[model samples]
Target: MAGTGGVSPSQTPTLPTQPGAMTPGRIGCAEIVRDLAWEHTPLGPRDRWDPAVTATVELVLTSPMPMAFCFGDRFVLIYNDAYADLIGTLHPAAMGRPAADSFGELWRSPGIGGVVEDVFRSGQPFLEPETQLTVVRAEGTRPEQAFFTRGHSLVRDSHGTIAGVLTVAAETTQVTRRLQNLSELTSRLAAALTVDDVARVVLGYAMASFDVDLCMFAVDDGNGFRAVRRIRGEMLDEADERLPPVWKRLSDDPHAPLVASARANRPSFVPDGEPLRAVASDRHERRIRALAVLPLRTASLKGSLSIGYRAAHTWLPAERALLNAAAQLVAQAAERARRFEAQHGTAQLLQRSMLPEHLPELERFRIAARYDVGVDGNAAGGDFYDAFRLADGRLAMVLGDVAGHDVRAAAVMGQVRAALRALALTEPDPPGVLAGLDRLVTSLGAESRNEEIFVTVVYGVLDPADGTITLASAGHPPPVLRRAGLGGEPPTAELVKVPPGAPLGLGGRWQTGLVRLEPGDSILMFSDGVVERRGRALNDGLDALVAVAAGASSGDPRNLCSLATTAVPGPTDDDVAVLAVERAVALSRSATMLVAAEPTGPSRVRQWMTTWLREWTVPEPVISSAILCTSELTTNALLHAGTPAQVHIDLNAVRLLVSVADTGTRGSVIRAHTDTMSSRGRGLGLIEELSDSWGTDPSVRGSTVWFELLLRSTSD
Candidate 1:
């Protein structure tokens, strides 16, 4: 009889009973099998074994492949040396034992156990292209996952009776690991929302997955393709490592591999550097031996992705497929980002056109406004702010938010803002203005077939004469007030308790709240985005805004607006608009002069101030003191600060205030002692003696020195 591989049964060798009794030439597991005592095994002594069984065992042990034979009913395990290495620590002792006892959990696994049983029962050969199993490769260590392609065939005895099953396995763990990495790349590409984002994800995946020496991504840049290349060991040239890789503009060489691939919408592979060196455009490309250029094709985008290795590499079919799939994913993401960018640009342009280009300037009140879009800059939000002069000389300020983040919402906001201005011209009162806006919004909603058009607005009118702001809210957050301290008290900030009414499109009555603002007091009105943060309560955000506003050192409306807009940390998910108005001290007259840095600057300022004060009629003594103080301040600013200064003079009912501000590195104002007799330092001395109150206000860049004189009752 002949065994499975044609070895004759008559050729079977006798088994050895004593150790080292086998042929000295046998190596590996062959030596171990020959020296084993077979009497204790299920098959009994080797001398009593069937001739066919002995022949099959000899064939398995002599083979170089990882092969195993399970004999008899218990399926006693017998394997070659290659099989011993495959099972790691489970070998040696596993010899002469049942297959189930040797493999442990691996033998009981669904794929392995069921297939082995089927092959044994049907006497058929079966093959599994790939199957996953977990095994302990070392003693006292955790089991690790492994993948393999296995083939199982039934073995026949000498009388042609079906016996046990034989198995052959080839590990495929490396290929399976690469496929897993490709799956991860697919997931990351789906989340990319911008062109630059897609490039970063693709290049990073190529570098990590392929271990390539160079990775490059190119995108259509109107005139040509612009490429961002990442090279190993080149990170030191980047100032910020967190930023995306450096970019280069490719020349208009159609012969270059990347350009050719993109133009033809195909992929090109170079297995050696000889061909690449002829068309190489740069030093990096010149040294690369293996390269792959894959075109990224999309309806709105034209680009290419390329990877290179320093040593020659054969591009396998599987690797080519994976690279092509990556390119397709990148192209889809790039298309989406292109569309978003186009829409976002148009929407933002439209939104800005609806807002006031410049705020109306008021003598007694300074106004400033700020606007910022949300983190998802793909859509246009509804927050808006404006300041315009009313017919009655009162300043009208409004900040409102429409409900949605689309073109329709932006259009409605424009309509509301234009209507607000018209209404304020006719009905200047806060309540009346809001009532008219409510009617307008309700009518708009009805026109849209009641699609739930929601809007919230806070409107205020400032009476410059009395320094009072009448405010009205329609389902909006209350305005915050930073009250200027009086009588040596620190400034305080608090939210105005305005009555909240129903939002627009819902019929409700609105009431006006009046808050009297003292000189230097500022009021801030903003959309809800200024006081709302993710993962935090609304009240906590509101309190944080109050703290930021109060902590500001200056009452300038511009500074307050800046601080309030940045009150919330991290990215904001909604639009923010802040409008700030500050009431200056009651001034009958004010004039400002830009003092030159030359020596003649102080004299010119003196002449200007003297002429202006005298023109107001009969203030000779006050005029002399004001001119002398002004000259001294201007001189000090030019000599010590080494910069031009601004001289501002304000005349009010009770006093005259003169301030000199300079933009320089110096942050403090010099104050000379009262008893100092040196002429060089007598400037501050004269200012101290002549003025009623003198002080210095330090700023971020420089300082402001000012002196006030209490006017006699006749000066006005």
Candidate 2:
């Protein structure tokens, strides 16, 4: 008999279980395991061990990978001679002990032990990409901690019963954390849109990642390096002029470390002593023990990033590479910030041009909007929102998003916005208008078919006379409607409820719905940017938005819009546009318009007035009077004031009122009055002679020219 350690040597099945010693390339651990005496172990001597145990041991010892197996129910620890050094001082002693005795806290830890036990019982495997293990380094030493990507697998006996667990692992603490820090560098820099934003990201990361005592960013302001930003530790001075510039400033001072690094275009570090003393502040001369400076030089940006340590520290090669990579990536983002800071005007123009010049404030409807751009340049974001009066006197509103955030994408957004406006002007309803927009966007993308530009849009029209909203969507988020009867817990916000439609450029049909509002009820339309986040369901963000908006029943229209748009709890990466329309019973009988600064040179106001009349289906004589008044007022403002004009028209059962406003005040009622032959200012003179009531009033921007006509009873 094999004395309970195994079957008798004569009865034991012959498997190639002693290959660890026979294998020529086997190393130290294998030789040690093969030669060590196992008097304390149940398995006894190696050659006399059971065939199953011997085979499992051989499989572990002969492999180059770090592997260990617990044999039998007692789980005796057995591992290859390899990894003795990596296993720390517990190696040789660990070979014969039980797993708990050898691994200390790691094997005894509830979280880790459960994993191993589960694999043993289920005959399944457990994998951990990175897990922490704490083990005693030596008999008297405290525990040493490390991270490993590890796995536990069941080692089956010859009869297919679970015998023990095989643990295969690789230590990855330093490497994994380093890569994570590197990835964080780019991700943090990606969000910076201004120099201040860049400084926050850079200075913050330096202190956290480098364990530095002082960190500084000296921007090169065209002339030379200026210490515009810095985070000084307790021992450092506020403004130490002794610190070196990024360029050749005070060149005679040869000890300038930053200038030297900038000139060399490489990283410079001083491990300790006098080299640091030259750069040290007078108050804390001895506090500076170590320093490193990395130069930042991209085509559009120049600066120096530096870190100082109060204690002595050597720059490891890996640490040095990581710092260099961070500086390089951050410098590129800084360059973008600088360029955007310089070219902000163009961006402002693009943004202004992308949205409606003004949102009309009429009776029965109140309007407000928020357009927040996520990127720096080309402020015309991928998202857009607009409201304008349609030909038939109803209010048409649009919300949309292009597929990307780039200058080209914003330009394309402008084109698509214009196309949608033109289509909405003539189309009968939102669905038909969306269908037209789909074909238009599809044709626009044909030239860049490989790139495949796409857009999502929601269009709606509101009739102030009845407080009704007809909305349509094409691959866009549905509009949210909230009903709150003058405060308290608002009702659950309801979606317009439409089938999902494909994005524009895909040639698909769309869906539409009609929403009727109560006194305090409001409708909100937004781009997905307002309600989408990573790692969460799309409906989760939508629900959060509705919850916030439902409670925003009592506030300024602007404030209500702001509250809903900023409902998301964290920073966002995409452009957001939110347009809110609330039923305003107070202004139901009025309409307003924003005249252009330059009236397209040749009387645009006349055409606009004629269209408004026809759209309202006003009596032919009222239409005629509105047209004549529009031509007279617009021509007077264009010829005399050379500035834009604003117009407001109001109707009641008794009369019709038209008011025109401009930047200039009434100048002695001068007009085309004197020049009957010339088509110049007949403005105030014509108003006085052709209407029932007329007056002039001063305004904040300039003056308002007003006129009113009595409507004869149609019944007569």
Q: Highest lDDT: which candidate?
A: 1
By summed lDDT, the worst window of 10 consecutive residues in model 1 runs over 12-21
Model 2 per-residue lDDT tens digits across residues 217-316: 6556655555433445432221111211112222323465655565567788778755546654454434767888898888766777878777788987
**Decoy 1 TM-score against native:** 0.56
TM of each candidate vs. truth: 0.56, 0.45
For candidate 2, the TM-score is: 0.45
Per-model CA lDDT versus the true structure = 0.73, 0.63
- lDDT of candidate 1 at residue 584, scale 0 to 100: 77
lDDT of 1 by residue, 556-578 (tens): 66667667867878667888888
Off by more than 4 A, model 1:
1-181, 236-248, 274-282, 310-314, 361-366, 391-393, 463-467, 484-491, 505-507, 516-521, 533-537, 552-573, 582-716
